[model samples]
Target: MRSATSKARFPILLLTLLVSISAAAGEKLTALQLFQAKRYAEAQIAYEQLAAADPGNAETHFHLGLLALRRNATDTAIAELERAVALDGKNSDYFAQLGSAYGAAAQAAGLFSKAGLARKCRVALEKAVELDPDNLDAREGLVAFYRQAPAFVGGGIEKAYAEAEEIKNRDVLAGSLLLAQLATGEKKYDAAFATLDRVLADHPDAYLALYAYGRIAAESGLRLDVGERHLRRCLELPPPARAPAHAAVQWRLGLIAEKRPDLPAARAAYAAALELDPAFSPARDALARLPKP
Candidate 1:
């Protein structure tokens, strides 16, 4: 009788252990499935439950952080993501998410806020790259963060240019366009023109680049003839049928005409832009400022 009782108790203990392991695994699987499905709210709840049950589960905390981010709960996301990174110090993804959370918080704090928040975001993103240099998403996020930040706070034409160059191997045209934008921002008219020329040389029919070149030429006041030619070429490109390139080209033409004080031509171009895009505020504003003929 004693032996049989002991045997029964041993089986009960084994069964309890198995059940606990199964429950934990099941919760984790459910959390992953919900996350993959983009059911962020549900995933958050599931992850929170799992986190409570297994307080040391870094993956659970990471998922919760990501879910909070999806819901735009920036503060909560930051806390959870920071905790996730703390628990799993080697994960680049965790650090990248934390950086994104900091960036969102800084953006919410308004443009005039202190540089500390932006710097924190920058550091976090940099650390993410240090941990995983091939993280494309982190690289892109860093690029965007630096681009939007003020020049006084570690953001400038040089930084933008470097970031663009870093990604040029993957997308030459995009990198060249970005470089041109940085050059234009810095008032480096010659450099901007050169960058645009390189892009156009490789892809002659790139309507977007042509349009950008036209604007850069018109604004820089260095090469009106070249600017006008680019603008006209942009207009001559075959339409993509669903894009607003036509409206954009008309707007650019109006801008050139306005610069030349050709009121009649400016008015015509603005009218064409508005015809294509009724909600184009710039064209409407330009039309309002024009002298009545």
Candidate 2:
């Protein structure tokens, strides 16, 4: 019943729609690529555009929230992360990131609001862990919360230790590092060092264990020479996904150098840290505070 002109018009409209869909997909891919490359500024703009075009796209909102967090935009990150969680409640990562955003907001909040924000963070992180027990990042956040929050807020040192044990049961390397961290926080430096030493003995090539040895020394101001040696060894190994970035190892080296009163070494180490990650604010701050030669 359709006229030839009408049929031709239908084909043209279909082709246009197909092309538009393809363009949208391509844009999303490019945005993701930028994000993976750590080009946060560009990724943020791209994600903003995508979110505007597809308001229901949870992934875009999630990445946008992460970008906001990188820039210390806590309120914006919370909003975007909340939107992502609302859109997809089943995503463990969304909950984990939302919990972190809440924790950041708590830090900046007045005393009266701090308890409430902290509670929100705990609840969100707990939910994330419940959703995905294997999510070590979520567990680590919960462990941190347990370590820092008062008993009145459902947190305690015992709880933190228990959570670390759970993490250790899953991934021995991550768990050992975490346990060492907790022990160090409690001023149990000997225990921390022993734990790391055992891991290194079992897996000599474990760069994370090496980094932890350096971190403990940096924090306790003990064994600076040994720590420097271990840290340098870390640099010789290829980093794993879960290990601290090279910048962090470099920062620790800077800390050791400072403790040694070797200003030049400290400056050079901090500079190297910044070279690895220009956005590493701690290195930048350390550099700024260093006395001018």
Candidate 3:
């Protein structure tokens, strides 16, 4: 009897193991994972498949919309995001991304369509902020809108400053960076410089801050020597962060060196950038333009 019972349990265990393996095989990754990995093409394909299988899935539509936006397919993005909103109107992130899509679409639209699209962008962004005040990205989007749009529309520089203050409460460095951007946009270079200096003084090894400072200083010709140092420091940052920006840093340093009359250094920098990103057009252009040493 005991031998018979043991034999019976063997089949049940096998069945359980097979079920687990099958479930594992069938598991689907969340769309956000693909999006965060910057695999927009793959994510779009996955989302398209998902939306076809589950026609009422708002998240699938929303992710498709995001992928379309990334690819600058404004019309498709609008259609997908509208469907997402219809299915899940309360999703603040969907509205925020939709707002961004509309904003981009407005840039190239005809005069007749431009005004209407801008209005839609403003309204969607506002709704996103209202729905989730804690969402830093949404707030930043609204701030950008406010800073860029004319006073005739639903945007004001004062409103942007107020939002900047709110951001400061959460992230001091981010707020300062925004403030610098605002000043730069307004052509208040001195003010922007002060803000960048403050950030670097506090966080000397801040990779992003250093990169921004270098780019600005180099482009503006404010302090080419100092800018070179900052760019070098940015390159020194270890791995992960450094790898993604390697080509960019090298290109910017090339530009600075070319303008500073250091032709050899400029050529070397451009060559380095090209070695990393073979198709980097800016570096190629700069390298071609340089006089041979």
TM-score versus the correct structure, for each prediction:
0.66, 0.80, 0.80
Per-residue accuracy of model 2 over 1-293 as CA lDDT, tens digit each: 99999999998999999999999999999999999999888998899999999999999999999998999999999999999999999999999999999999998999998998899999999999999999999999999999999887778999999999999999999899889999999999999999998888889878988998998998899989988999999988888886788899999999999998898999999999999999999999999999998
Error of 2 at 121 (Å): 0.7
Listed per model in order, the count of residue pairs whose N, CA or C atoms clash below 3 Å is 0, 0, 0
Q: Which regions in candidate 1 have their CA more than 4 angstroms from the true location?
A: 1-73, 80-94, 110-113, 131-137, 140-157, 235-245
Q: What tens digits encode model 1's per-residue C-alpha lDDT throughout 1-293?
A: 56988988998999999999998898899889988998877887888889888888888888888888888898899889889998999999999989998888898886556477788888889899899877766777777877778776677555666777876666776677777877788798899999888888989887767877888876766676677788888778876554447777788787788787688988999999899889988888988988899
TM-score for candidate 1: 0.66
Error of 3 at 99 (Å): 0.4
C-alpha lDDT of candidate 1 relative to the true structure = 0.82
**What lDDT tens digits, residue by residue, belong to model 3 across residues 113-162?**
98788888899988887888877888898889898877766778989988
The residue ranges of model 2 lying beyond 4 angstroms of the native Cα positions read 218-232, 235-293
Worst lDDT run of 10 residues, candidate 3, spans 23-32
Q: Judged by lDDT, which candidate is best?
A: 2
Candidate 1, 55: how far from true, in Å? 9.9
Question: lDDT for every model?
Answer: 0.82, 0.93, 0.83
Q: What TM-score, to 2 decimals, does candidate 3 have?
A: 0.80
